[model samples]
Target: MISRHRKVLREARVVGSERRGTWVYYWVLPPALERLPALLQVPEPAASTSW
Candidate 1:
């Protein structure tokens, strides 16, 4: 899991991380932050009239 996260961060180039003591913290870079909403959006599901 950690490897996968690292790979994505490296590939995206839109995340910044810092280590404080034993903990590492990450945040979206400014340019990426501006586009984050659109990146995270998903299409609405089709309406279901019958359950």
Candidate 2:
């Protein structure tokens, strides 16, 4: 549940959701977002929205 922890990182904000399909978009806070790739190391869906 990285998405949940993403909140703890204080760097994630729910930007949008795709009701047509199962997907969510998040705005990863800059600095943290930068480090996220290395930290969580998970493949995320392509984000298509901004908070």
Candidate 3:
């Protein structure tokens, strides 16, 4: 499933990766992070105790 997402992102030019030996490393383009909303999305209110 992850590989499928990676392929999509790669085709969209949203990310890049490199394969080394038996491992593959993936990365989101640096500028993309800045364009994204905060990683936590809507902040939890103080009284919200559970996810």
Candidate 2 segments whose C-alpha is farther than 4 A from its true place: 1-27, 42-51
Report the lDDT tens digits of candidate 2 across residue range 2-22. 767755544343232234457
Give each model a TM-score: 0.50, 0.25, 0.56
lDDT against true structure, model 1: 0.83
Candidate 1 vs. true structure, TM-score? 0.50
Q: What would the per-residue lDDT of candidate 3 be over residues 1-51, giving only the tens digit for each residue?
A: 988988998897679889999998889988767767775488776885766
The positional error of residue 32 in candidate 2, measured at the CA in angstroms, is 1.0
Off by over 4 Å in 3: 37-51
Candidate ordering by lDDT (highest first): 1, 3, 2
Sort the candidates on TM-score, descending order.
3, 1, 2
Candidate 3's displacement at residue 11, Å, is 1.0
lDDT of 1 at 28: 75
